[model samples]
Target: MTAAITATKAFGATSTTDEVLEGVNLAGKRVLVTGVSAGLGVETARALAAHGAEVVGAARDLGKAKGATEKAFGKTNGLTLVELDLASFASVRAAADGLVADGRRFDLVICNAGVMATPSGKTADGFETQFGTNHLGHFTFVNRIASLMRPGARLVNLSSAGHQMSDVDLDDPNFERTPYDPWAAYGRSKTANILFAVEFDRRHRERGIRAAAVHPGGIQTELSHHLDDDARRRMTEVVEELARRPGARPFSYKSIPQGAATSVWAAVVGKADEVGGRYCEDCHVAETIDAEGFTFAGVRPYALDPEHAKALWAKSEAMVGERFP
Candidate 1:
């Protein structure tokens, strides 16, 4: 489904979280925001909580998450913390089980936690670090809590424009047979995130659950901590090239509130259901680009394929040793 509300100049590339959520009240709603210890996750949770939603901030360090939530939401009346570590299947399962034990239902699940281009490594379960932590980890977590989603619940997966760098290679997701390129692996994982949302929406929309993928605009966040001096230079050159494109807004960093805008927009915007199974950016469904040079914006066609999404979902279930059903 396409968005009922088309992209408008009013909410442009520089829109902030509070701007996107203006006048939208989320009273009595329950939201789960992963990786809320810092960066976009914290801002996403903060914005939602400020609008009166019960926000659960999931992170690996509960103490740090508490402090972060306190800082973001002040007294933490509308915010809570849960322990989760996407790199570990055990941690993911434990977190989900605990949430289930609480008998709470979530109106939205935002998979906002992820590691970007990092050095080649394996997750605790022997999967590639980027793909494993960013894709499979969220895959298992979502499946485990599938039944707890309230009717009309939305699942928002945080993808990236970096997905244009590569497509998923289902046969060697662990990098066992091919040389590992950190950027390519990150791209594949981001693509997987988009595809996961596509398949998820297809499977669950009938049950009143819809999913969407979001590419939060480029921001200088902790997610870039792995970049070295040379890596940062290369990224800067790419962004500069993107800025030079005709009619393109110059590439610029976003504040935490700005980076979290699309996410909050996807989670609660009234017309979001119309755009289920699509990738979004800048507070609306992103355009599809087919150019050669760095476009820096929009979703790639392959990342939205339903077939690729289904295949990845099956492979993820096998790798994690759990079936969604």
Candidate 2:
């Protein structure tokens, strides 16, 4: 489950969504992708839908989503939209409920909507903004729709390499006792994304369902717009310093197509058992790195630890006031 597959060695960081999914036919599949109003989400939906799958995209702004998807779809069809604001529990519940009531099963669920580093704030439900929108929101929404996933369904959570910066603090996920560092808060939330996948895969894989987290690589999307000039400069300095280390891969911005490629790779191309409960990037299961600092190619060991994932599941359940068996 940890090693990269030779079968997927043909694809890597530079691969586009179409490149990775070339010759792959997804006919009759049903996929749900969130955050479709922009960036990777639109491309992910576009590629899947174009390849003959029905994709229901969720977005906070339905108006914007309609415009974006229409443009992305171009000559392609099979893409639909649902209203969802991960920042609001009401929206999450309503969306989940509507999908459940419809009685249709999904072959894949990609939790891709998230806010990056931003000024400290709280959700409508009073949880930390980054943690709430990025993790708790998807936690509640996905669990509610769990029954709709077909037995062989795969759940792909769009995590980030930033998870290397820190581990989730169960006792203080909202940064109550700890000082709020934007990148650390973002890291905690992203790591939660991975842990959520780990636990979900463990709980559901017996039923022919599995989950994996994905790091989409560094893409120049609006995802990082929250970073001010100084913040961006500081991040650049850190990456530059890291690049100078022995055997480090220098970071470079990826095209949106390349960014969305890994999510597509995990949801459709990866073998269920090989990728289940693992963290993937560049179309392969990433090696678990034991070193300090983030790298372009691997996941941190803590991100995949069973005990860490289990604790996150419990804490997430408590935070959202819901539990899944």
Candidate 3:
């Protein structure tokens, strides 16, 4: 039997991106990050570039991405933008194929682009919005560019604690029959993110390519913009109750740097074998929590179930209408 994965006490939810990446040098490393137009994506790219890595930022709007990076990073030492709309398979294929054609190897790939609590809608390809953009888009793009990942490279999928909300519904991923609930849909997609990493790790470990999923903690970024005032207030109350501490405002969730810490930590700082095929948060490997209701920490067993990961992989290939050998 394999040894268990454990968390590192070196950093927790409060650590910032720079803190986790403090002493690491990435001079010759190249990384691809999605959703760099805003939020953790921009921050993740900035932090990585600040540490000397060549960062290729992907966004639906190149202009917006360039503006955001300029506003955030100020100086672009090793940063460039790629147009990618995760909600559409055509765009996904084009972007991935372009990278493959370029034949540039990447040391890390951070699937950081995603939407949360989005309205009921289908992707350009007719898949559910959250699942299509967050899970399937990354699925197709990553697999297509699999050849460009250097040996010993790693893939980081930005999952969430919201994954505790629901598991993947392979029978009805499109919500054709089930009534569409925003959070549940978000949960399913996030859960899919974890399962994808698990399966990807299994498939590529022999080639030294590892994958892990992480929750970047909560930050009031563009990701939560879909929720209105009432929804936002309710979310705040839930977080307050979870914290069980007085004056636990939602605004106190996490700073952008702190929020992006786990992404960089998992991608380059953490122990590769220990983090391979696992779900992490707060810059450490989270324990597997098997219980009802949201404990607000650790990962659910279903998110790490190997059989479930395999099942999702098969289903994803079918949904995307392509199989990766």
What tens digits encode model 3's per-residue C-alpha lDDT throughout 265-291? 899888889899999988899999998
Candidate 1 global TM-score: 0.94
Q: Which parts of model 1 have CA positions greater than 4 angstroms off?
A: 1-9
Residue-by-residue lDDT tens digits, candidate 1, 91-172 = 9999999999998999999999999888888899888999999999999999889888988899999999999988899999
lDDT of 2 by residue, 200-269 (tens): 9999999899999999998888888888776688688878987898987767889999999999889888
TM-scores for candidates 1 onward, in order: 0.94, 0.96, 0.94
Note the Cα lDDT for every prediction shown: 0.87, 0.90, 0.90
Judged by TM-score, which candidate is best? 2
